[model samples]
Target: MTFLHTIGAIFIFAPFLAFIMFVLLSRKKLKRRSIGFSADLTTFLLFISVPVSVESLWGLEISFAVAVTAILIAIFLLVIEWKKSKEIEVLKYIRKTWRLYFLLLSVSYILIWATGLALTVISFA
Candidate 1:
């Protein structure tokens, strides 16, 4: 595999490993907050990985696929958040950690998309 491919693999898979760790470590606490955080993290990783995997296996353009998947996931999350906004308890925790959540999502997408863009550019070279 090339250097770009290796970086792409890491960008796609690292979150998955972190998710597993979150699950394992949170078993002791097992609170709703931890569970919710883990779920959101998992969702984010899944959203990022689907397109990256498709591009890797099928030789599709990464930038377009990643962008589409990211937008779709953002819309889906927004809808879910809107529907659940009435739940004060859930909203409280979500609001408290919203920054962290956004940061994670932003970083993951940026890394994946950057790697994808690099790979695409290399392919055309």
Candidate 2:
């Protein structure tokens, strides 16, 4: 139980741990299986990590952040789609939104990680 919790926390905090694990296990087989699986897995983990990272960095509740992030992405995609074709291309927009969110969350995760490290150093100093 405790071990499982630790593993869960590690995955939540690292974001790409599971993705890396998969890639390592897949090795050459991963090429034949396709790179998309790794990307999709990282993206899914980012969905959880963004809010967790925010909360850890700020010591504030970010439970609603995930929902808000998803909603905002949807709205932004809708706007882009409207500009692109002025119609609901559900499949296209959804895929675009997921990719965009991955980039956005990846940036957030890096920033948060840096901030945390800086804060730790500052506290020591």
The top-ranked prediction according to TM-score is 2
**What would the per-residue lDDT of candidate 2 be over residues 57-117, giving only the tens digit for each residue?**
8877775877797798799779878987867878877877877777787788888899999
lDDT (C-alpha) at residue 16 in model 2: 72
Q: Per-residue CA lDDT of candidate 1, range 9-56, in tens?
A: 674655566566777788778865675566566656655675565566
Error of 1 at 7 (Å): 10
Q: Rate the local accuracy (lDDT) of all candidates.
A: 0.62, 0.79
Q: Please give the RMSD of candidate 2 to the true structure.
A: 2.4
| Model 2 spans with C-alpha error above 4 angstroms | 26-34, 86-88
TM-score of each: 0.41, 0.80
TM-score of 2: 0.80
